[model samples]
Target: MNMKRNSVGDKVFDCFNLTGLFILVGLILYPLLFVAIASLSEPDQIYNAAFLLWPKGFQLESYRIVMENPDIWIGFVNTIVYTVSGTLISMILSVLGAYPLSRSDFKGRRFFSFFITFTIFFSAIGGMIPLYFVIDKLGMLNTMWSAILPGGVVVLNMIIIRSYFETKIPMEVQESAALDGCGNFRLLFSIILPLSKPVLAIMILFYFVHHWNAFFYALIFITEKDKYPLQLVLREILVNNNLNNLLPTMTDQNYLERLKQQQSLKYAAIVITTLPVLVLYPFVSKHFKEGLLVGSVKG
Candidate 1:
C-alpha cells in the first residue's frame, strides 16, 4: 500500500502546529519550573533575577524550614485525612446515586436526575448563604464534617458515572447476572464495579484532587488553626502572608533576612502542596481520556 505524501501547505501547517504546541507547553511549564527552582534558590538571588531557568545559589534552607514547621506537618496530616475521607464519601454517594439513575427500569430515575442537575444550577445562583445556614442549622460549623459532608456528591461527577454505566455496561450483562441469582448489591459490588474501573479511577482522581486542593470550605467552616487543611494553611502563607506563627521570633538584626526568606518559603509551600497531585496524575492518566470521553459523550 502506498502512503499519501504531504503537500507543501500541509508541511507548513504541521510545522506551525508543532511550534505553537511547543510554545504553549513552555508557557504552562515555566511557572512550575520557576517555582521549583525558586524554592531551592537563595532568597536574595530569586528577587535579583528577572526570569529563572535554573536554581541560583542553591540551598535547602526553605525546605528545611517548611519541614520543621509543626503547623505544616499538622496541616499535611489534616489535609490527608480530609482528602481520603472526603473522596471516599463523595465516591460512595456518587456511585450509589449514579447506579440507580443509570437503570432504565428504576422508578423516578428521570425525576431524581433532573432534581440533582437542578441543584447544580441552583448552587450557581448564590446558594452559599443558604448552604452556610443549613450547615449552621445542622450544628456542623467549625467541624471537619462541615467541610466533608456539604460537598459529598458532585452532580457533574455523578452524571459522568451514570452516563458511563448506561452506555458502557450492556443491559444483557446485568440481566444475565440477575438470572444467575445475583442480588442487586452483589451484582453492583462484584460485577458492575469491577467492570467500571476506568471510570471509577478517573472519578477517584477527580475527587481526590478536588479534596486535596480545597480550602474555601475549610476557611469558612474551620475556625481552629489546628483543624485547617494544607490548602487553608497555604492560603495564610501565600495570600495573607501570615508567616509570623510559622517562623520563629526574630531580632531586629535578622528581621530583614527572615523577610527575604519568606519569598523562598512561599515557593517551597507551593511545591509541597502541589507535589501529591503531580505524583497522582500519572497513575490514573491512562484511564483519564477514555473514561472522560465515554462518560461525557452520552450525557
Candidate 2:
C-alpha cells in the first residue's frame, strides 16, 4: 500500500505548526537559559548585556557565595526533609482516600467525595484566616509539621488517583484476587499498588514538586530562620534583598563590588532552588503522559 502524499495545504499547515512550536519552546526555554548563564557570568557583563546567549567571564563565585551561607545549607536540608516527609504523607493519604472512593461497594463514597470536593471551591472563598487559627490552636505554628501536615492531602491529586483507579484498573483483576482468598490490605499492597505504578509515579512527582517549592505556609508559620525552607530562604535573598547572610563582611572598599555580585547571587539562588524539580522530572517523565491522560480525564 502506498502512503498518501501531503497536499500543498497540508504541507503549509505542518510548516506553520512546526514554526509555532519551535517559537513557543524557545520562549519557554530562554528565561531558564538566561538565568543559568547569568548565574555564572560576571555581574557587570550580565547587567550590561541585552540578552544572554552564553556565559561571559564564567566563574563559580556566585555558587560559592550561595553555598557558603549557613542559611542556604539549612534551608536546603529543611526543604529535602519537608519534600520527602510531605510526599510520603500525601501519597499515603491520597491513595488511602482514593482507593476507597474508587470502589463501587464502598458506602457513602459519593457523599465523602462530594464533601472533599466542596472544599476546593469553598477554599477559594477564603479560608486562610480560619486555617491559621486552627494551626495556632493545634500549636503547629513555627513548627516543621505546620508546613508538612496542613497540605498532606491535595484534593485534585486524590481525585486524579481515584479516576485512575476507577477507569484504568480492571474490575476483573480485583475480582480474581478476591477469589484467591486475598484480603483488602494484602490485595492492595501486593497486587493493586504494583500495577498502579504509573499513576503513583505521577502522584509522587506532583506532591514532591509541590512540597519542594512550597513557601507561603512556611512564610506564615515558620518564624525561625533555621526552620525556613529553601523557597523562603530564597525569598529572603531575592525579594527582601537580605544578603547579609550570603555576603562576606562589607567595608567601604568592597561594598560596591559586593553589591554588584548580588545580582549573580540572586540568579544563582534561583537556579539552585529550581535544579531539584528539573532533576526529578526526567525520572518520572515516562509515566507522566499516561498517568496524566487517564488520571485527569475523568475529573
Query: lDDT for every model?
Result: 0.90, 0.91
Name model 1 segments beyond 4 Å from true: 124-126, 251-255
What shift in Å separates residue 274 of candidate 1 from its native position after superposition? 1.3
TM-score against native, each model: 0.95, 0.95
lDDT by residue for model 1 (205-298), tens: 9999989988888888789999999998899899999998667888999978888899999999999999999999999999977788898778
Ten contiguous residues minimizing lDDT sum, candidate 1? 120-129
C-alpha lDDT (0 to 100) for residue 174 of candidate 1: 96
Per-model tally of clashing residue pairs:
0, 0
- How many residue-pair clashes does candidate 2 contain? 0
**Total clashes in model 1, counting residue pairs 3 or more apart in sequence or in different chains:** 0
